[model samples]
Target chain A: MKTILESIALTKIFKTGKIEVTAVRDVSLKVPEGEFIAIMGPSGCGKSTLLHLLGGLATPTSGRVLVDGEEISSGKDAVRTDIRRRKIGFVFQRFNLLPTLSAQGNLEIAQEIHRNGSRDRQHVDEILNLLGLEKKTHHKPSELSGGEQQRLAIARAVINRPAILLADEPTGNLDTRNSMVVLKMIQELNRALSQTILMITHNPEAAGIANRLIEMRDGRIVSQQQEGEWNAAEDRMSL
Target chain B: MSSQLILSNVVSRPMRSLATALAVGVEVALILLLVGLSTGMIRENSKRMSGVGADIVLQPPNSSLVLAASTGAMSVKIADLVSGIEGVKAVAPVYLQLNTSGGLGLVWGIDQESFNGITQGFVYREGRGFQGPDDVIVDDIYADARELRLGEEITLMNRSFRIAGIVEHGKGSRLFIPLGTMQRLVGTPGQATMMMIKCHDKSDIPGVKAELEGRLKSYPIFDMSSFAAHLEEANRDFGPIKFFTRTVVFIATLIGFFIIFLSMYTAITERTHEIGILKSLGAPQGYISLLFLKEALVLGGLGFVLGLGLTFGGRFFFQLLMPTLQHQLPPEWLLYTGILALFSASLGALYPALRAARQDPIEALAYE
Candidate 1:
């Protein structure tokens, strides 16, 4: 399989009042096309920071991140932003959808920012249907339930058909039923569209749905496991 | 695509800020209109004074006020002496009598041939030239008020003359009659109030003024160009009134500025988060600034239109209420309105545009 994203010795250090804290330390990661991977970590383990770095939202202090075999981080700020817009899509823990726009308008805004003119109601409807959000197209984020708003954010993230969808705590605010629905949709999108998805979550059960799982502790990956093994342990824990 | 979305967002939000901007714009426009009207009046007066056909005015010393007040005089003999001056194309001696209305009315006695050579026949709405030595040409205002018309005989200074025509002059009410007849009626044969001189060379105004002033130092010699300067001097003479009007305009514009600033500041505050959303969505800082500018310009434009209409309408209404408002239209209206629109828009947008442009995308996005 062709590697869609590769990071070599990715490191990030943040300064907070006379101390330099390592958020991600010399972390190297590889994500292939059509792969579903989850990065599971305890609180402050830098899983979200890793995802942000991979998504081009922040620059790594010392490392290289390549998307589709292209080195985007070495160029100017404008070029990095363009790559972020064209190649990567992000889903935040808080949904981050503009409260003023309706669900449909929110999706439209994402498409517009990317300068994708082929977007239409039909495309929006298809994504909404996939996420079971067809009936709530006109609803504002404030009016929608937490689960629905998260689903809408997911729909918006994948609407541009990015090479990779980076979701940070995609279902952190949802109940078990809604979380299962979102997991199934992410799985289906990966299988059907050959889309690579990198999701971050602390829930082992949530991580169990990915094809592979990497566990992190103290800004370093400590373990890697297949989906079957992770699921079996999660089932045992639930029992 | 980003620009279109930003525009839609800005337009969709409706609040008190928009109303305040519109109000500021309206006030700015009204102020512009007022300034335009005043400047227009000055320009119109200048035009009428310098317009072709009326070349010279003869009067007693301090005749600027006298002509404005329509008082004082020069003997008829001076008119005859000036008529013989070289390059004196045509001459008409004028006599004046103050009426009960407190306005000066000219009793101009001209030889039929010399008058036609010098003064262009007044633009008459309803009449013809003097038919005989006893006939007269009255002003439109005086004729309209008194219900007099052409061929109707009227008495001035106890002499009856037929109303030959009703005329329009930019300055004052005037009645034209035959020279011999006017001299007999006013008891001043071969002696006139003042003479109107028409020169052969329009460019030789300085030479004529010098020659005439030197010859008639006892009397006042006013060329047409001097009237414009005299009007400026007159305006300067009423120093307090000029200062007061300027100060009032400045205060009114400053008030407009404050209203615009408050409106824009509130708008920026309310939209800080929205602005962050836009920036995160990839809107450039310049585009964000443009949005605020567009709002200010819209407000200014609407206000200017409203104010211009009000000013112009007020001018005509004043003319209707008092007939002396005819002197209030000119080219300066264009200049003042343009300046006011620019001033109001810039004053209103300066701070708001800077604040909007300097907003940080990260902080704005993180705002709750």
Candidate 2:
């Protein structure tokens, strides 16, 4: 498999009124095409910050991030924006849907921006159906359940067929049942469509659905396990 | 999609959008109504001046073109001298008094036979003109406005006068009294404000004007064409009224600017997270800015239409309140006012839009 995303010696530091905090230390990682990878850590371990750096949503303090062989970490904002619209999609924990727009409107806006004002209605309907949100396309975010809203958010993310999908705590706010449903859909996307995905979560069960699991501690990747190895490890831990 | 977003945002907050649009509408209506009144008044005055049917107007030196501003400066004897000039057919001595009883109006005191000769005659809508010194011949507009009937007594200049006739408008002042009576009331016996001169043939007007210029040195002589132009020029300046109109325009522009600025600014503050979502979706800065501007454009367009409605409404209201007041709705002015409203709204939204566009996506996303 080809490496679709690569981060080299990534570091991130945040400053507030002369107080500096190191969020992420020098860490390097690579994601291959069609792989489902999850990063697991406790709160405040810089998992989200690392994901942001990889997605080009934030500039690293000292590092380089490459998306599909293009350097995006040091690119201009316009260049980064172009790359993001063309090749990257982001799903946030909060759903981050425009409240004023309906579910279909939310997806259309993303497609509009990605395609520079052109839309593919067929693709949009397909994505809506795939997410099981076809009947609720006209419903506003507020009118949708937690699982439905998150599904709508995911549909919006992949509506334009971006090269890679970055999901930050995709099911953090959902109940166990909904979380399983969302995780299963994500797993199906990777299996059926070969869509590359990077997810961050605190739930080991959610991480269990991924082909690979990377555990972080203090901004460093302390351990990496394949699906079989992580499953066996989880069974032993439960014992 | 952008349009849908803009519409949804505006519809989402009905009261704010409506109030902002109403403010813009009021600004536009003020400009149209003020400009309309002044322009209409000028046109009406010019029409009446032309309707006098005089080939030339001879005024006392230093007298104003506005008859209402003229005093009894020259003696009525000037009419006789001009009538004696070659090609001179008739001359009417007119003593003008500015009446301020009910409103600011001009009262023309005229010599009945000569005034009739120069004007061909007043087109009487009711009765005869000037039956006595205390009888006033009002124009039809004035009669209808005041709800007066023929032979009804009305007080003017602190003196009672009967309505001898209601003549068609556009021949001269709305109220006409005998020249001798006006001269006596003002204590300026034999004095006239100006003389309206007619020529035997229209071709002889230029000759008569030149003759008067040579024969009556230092006196102001204007042929009908120049007189009409002068009236239009005076109307254009309109002195104090012109100043007032400009002041209103300046204030209206500022009001429009501040109203849109505050509205957009508040909207931007409220939509920070939405803006962040757009930014994260790969929306360029210009797109985000354009979204806000399009919203303002919609508001301005609605406001412009509403402004026109308010303008016509105001015109009708004023017509009922003051019948003699004239109003004109020039199409060019309507277009300019529409442009002005849109420009003010766009200008007002510029800062907020750019500010919203420049927001950091990360910080904006984190905004609670």
Candidate 3:
């Protein structure tokens, strides 16, 4: 499979006054077309920062990121923003749907930001139906339940038919049932819609559904487990 | 997306939006009233003075060059001196005063014989001219408005006088009594407001005007054409008044500007999280800034509409109460006010839009 996204030797540093903190250090990763991958880590382990760097939402302090082999990691704001608009969709852990807009409004906004002709009403309706948000399309973010909001955010992320979907803790705010529903919807998008997805999660169960799982500790990937490899590792650890 | 975002923000805070619009409306109305009243005065004065039909008009030194009000201070004496000049045909002594009962009305007193001799262009509609010291000739429009007719009695300066005749329109005044009666009535027995001079021939006007100017340096001599030009020049006196009004307009605009600025700034500040979400969705800075700008522009448009309503309503009531003040609500004024409202609103939104554009996507999304 062609590599849809790749990050090489990416490092991010935070400088507050006289103090310097290294958030992400020398991380290299690749995601192939139509692949579903999850990165699991403890708090402050730089999972979110890595996701941002991959999605072109932030310029890495050093190294670079590629989308379809096009370097997009280090550039001006407009360049990165343009690449993000063309190729990336983001779903945050907090379900970052615009509270002022309805479910459909959020999806429409995504298509509009894409600046392409992908904002077909029929396609939007079909996606909403697939996400089971057809009945809740007119509801605001606040009006929807936690699980519904997460699903709407996911629908918005993919509405533009982006090259890749970058989700950081997509189900972190949902309950157990909601988390399962959201994870299943994400898996459906990855398999049925052939969407390339990179998700960050702290839950091993959430990582279980991914085709591949990469575990991180203290800002470094400890090991990568493929399909069934994660389940095997979990079983071995439990024993 | 830009339009939808703007509409949502505006609709979300209906009260704040209305207040900002109303502030703009008030500023526009202030400009309309101030500019309209001054324009009305200039236009009306030119109309009345142009209708006089005299070759030359002479007035007291300090009075308006064309309106010819005497203030009862100029001696009826100027009429005699001007009449004795070469080629002088008629010298009509007239006393003009502002009536206390009505608006800035002129109460004119004329000598019937000499005033009638010149083709003053007044047509009598009913009855005869003034026959007694107590008889007055009233204007046709004033008669119809006040429901007055020939032989009807009306009080002037506490004195009851009969309306001996009704005259046609364009005579510049409603109440017309005998010149001697007006001089005695206003307690200035030998004073006249101004003298309307007619030469024996149209060619003799220049000589007569020159002679009058040379003899009475305290008085100004203006032929009909020059009088119109003089009035046009006098229109410049409104410059300071207009400047003062414009200063007030600027202050009013500032109030509207600040209202929109503060409200939009605070609103954007409160919505920083939403901005972050938009940015994460691949929305650009221009898009976010345009959202706030369009919102401000809409508020300005609303304010302009409200201001126009207020201006027309206020003009109607003001005219109803004071019939003498002419308010010409020019169409261009409305257009100008509308444009200014939009411009000011946009100006107010600029800072906030820039601030919104500069918001960091990560920091904004991370905002709680």
Candidate 4:
């Protein structure tokens, strides 16, 4: 399988006046096409920062990141923007949906940006149905429930069928029931549609649904585990 | 869709948007009034000078034109020298003095026979035109303004004068009297402010003007075709009303600029998180900047239309309410004012738009 994403010793440093803080340090990683991977860590461990670097949302201070074999770490803003638009879809913990737009309008914004005003209604209906948002299509974010709004956001994120989905704590604001629903929907998108996903989360249950898991601590990757081996590792760690 | 977003944003806060637009509207209305009054004054002054139906107007070398008349004293004898010019058919030496009624008033002193023969477009609406030494013809504006009836004596310049006739407006001065009476009253007998000359043929104006200029080399001369230029040049010496119109327009633009700047900046601050989300969605910097510009443009367009309506309607009521004041707003000025309002609002929005566009996606998303 072709590697869809690769980050070689990627490091990100943020400068605040006289102090320099490293958010991601010497992190090397790779994911094949159609793989679903989860990064698990405590808060402030730079998992989100690592996801940001891989998704072209932020540039690394050192090393390189490649998406579909094209180098993006050193690309200029416009090129990085183009990559993000055409290849990556992001979902935030807060949903980040425009409140003024209906679920349909929000989906249309993504659709229009992807093809410059060309839209496939059937494709949109399919995504909405897949996310169980068909009935809530015309509802604004304010009118939708927490789970419905998150689903609408997921629908918006995938409406363009981008190559990769980068979700950062997508269920952080949801209740346990809604969190399970969103996680199940994400797993369905990966398993049924062969979609590639990279999610940052603190939930072990959420991590268990992914095909592979990477654990991070102090801005560095500590271990990588496959789903087949994850159960045994969890058992041994608990012991 | 982007423009639609801007529209939705505007509609979301109707009062703030309207207040901003109304502020701009006030500026537009003020600009319209200022331009209207000043241009009207300039045009009316030129009209009065040209309305004497004169082929040439001769004044002292340095005489300046006030709003409705010439200033800087000169010899009334210029009429004698100018009347001898080759094509000169008639001469009228006009004595102009500013008088006060309720507003700035122009009083013209003319010899009835000569001034009336050369002047056209004047017809009495009631009574007669200038008969007795103390008799005067007042335009409808002044008559209606002072509520003077025919044969009513009104004190002017501390001298009592009877209103013999009330001529229609636009004929000339608000007040007219006999030349000798005014000359004596002003204590400048045999002196005139300017001389009006009529040629036998209107086409012979160039020849008449050349002849006058040759004999009266020290005097400033004017003809019908070059009247605006001449008045403007003469006005240079009198010190134009630099503050009345230009200053008002400058202040109006400044007000419009600051209003839009502060309003848009506040709006951007309020929508910082939205801007960040848009950026994270892969919206280009240009796209983000364009959203703010579109907002301002829509606001400006709204303000411009409102201002135009108010200016026209307000001026109508004002002109109707105050018969003494003349308010004439030309179409070109109306169009210019509309453009200025729009342009000022857009210009004011530029800095805020740039600031919004430059906001980082991460910071904006986290903004409160």
Among all candidates shown, the one with the greatest lDDT:
2
TM-score for the A-chain in each candidate structure: 0.92, 0.95, 0.94, 0.94
Considering every candidate listed, which one attains the maximal TM-score? 2
Residues B65-177, model 4: lDDT tens digits: 55345556677777777777788888888888887654576788888777765675368889976677999888887788667899998877778899888887764567889
Judge the docking of candidate 1 as incorrect, acceptable, medium or high. incorrect
What's the CA RMSD for each of the models?
Answer: 8.6, 2.9, 5.3, 3.9
Model 2 regions lying over 4 Å from their true place: A231-239, B66-72, B125-127, B131-135, B149-164, B184-188, B217-220
Comparison by lDDT, 1 against 2, better one = 2
Model 4, global lDDT: 0.81
How do the residues A1-239 of candidate 2 rate in per-residue lDDT, one tens digit apiece? 89999999999999998999888898899899999899998899999999888887788999999999988788477777778888898999999999999988999999899989998888888999999999998998999999999999989988887788999999999997888788888888888989999999988877877889998988888899887886545542221
Model 3, B1-368: lDDT tens digits are 65776788788888888888888889888888877887776666666666666788887787764353334258877778888998988888788866666334667888888777554546889987878999988877677767787898888767788999998766556677899998888788888777888888999998988888888888866898878667756763555665786787789788888888997898888899988887887777888888889999999998998898888888998777665567876688788888888888999999999899888889899888
lDDT string for model 1 (B1-368, tens) is: 34444445445665553565456556655555455455545555555445435577777754543333444556666766777777777776655443333343435566656656665656778777777788887777667656776788787666677888877754323566777786776576665565667888887666777788888786767787776677555643455546865776677667667776777777788778767655544444555677777776665565566556666676667567645334343456446654666576667777897798667554565666
Q: Name the TM-score of candidate 4.
A: 0.88
Comparing only chain B with the true structure, the TM-scores of all models are 0.59, 0.94, 0.77, 0.89
Q: lDDT tens digits, residues B1-368, model 2?
A: 88888999999999999999999999999999998998888778888888999999988888877666665379888887888888989999998898887677889889999999999999999999887889999999999998999999988898888999999999978899999999898899989988999999989998999888898887888998889889878767767777998999889988988999999999999999999999889898889999999999898888888899999999999999889999987789998999999999999999999999988888888888
Lowest summed lDDT across 10 adjacent residues in model 1 chain A is found at: A230-239
Overall local distance difference test of candidate 1: 0.70
Ranking by DockQ: 2, 3, 4, 1
Error of 3 at B220 (Å): 6.9
| Location of the lowest summed lDDT over 10 successive residues in candidate 4 chain A | A230-239
lDDT of 3 at A82: 80
Q: After superposition, how far is residue A221 of candidate 4 from its true place, in Å?
A: 2.6
Clashes of each: 3, 0, 1, 0
RMSD of 1: 8.6
Alpha-carbon error at A208 in model 4, in Å? 3.0
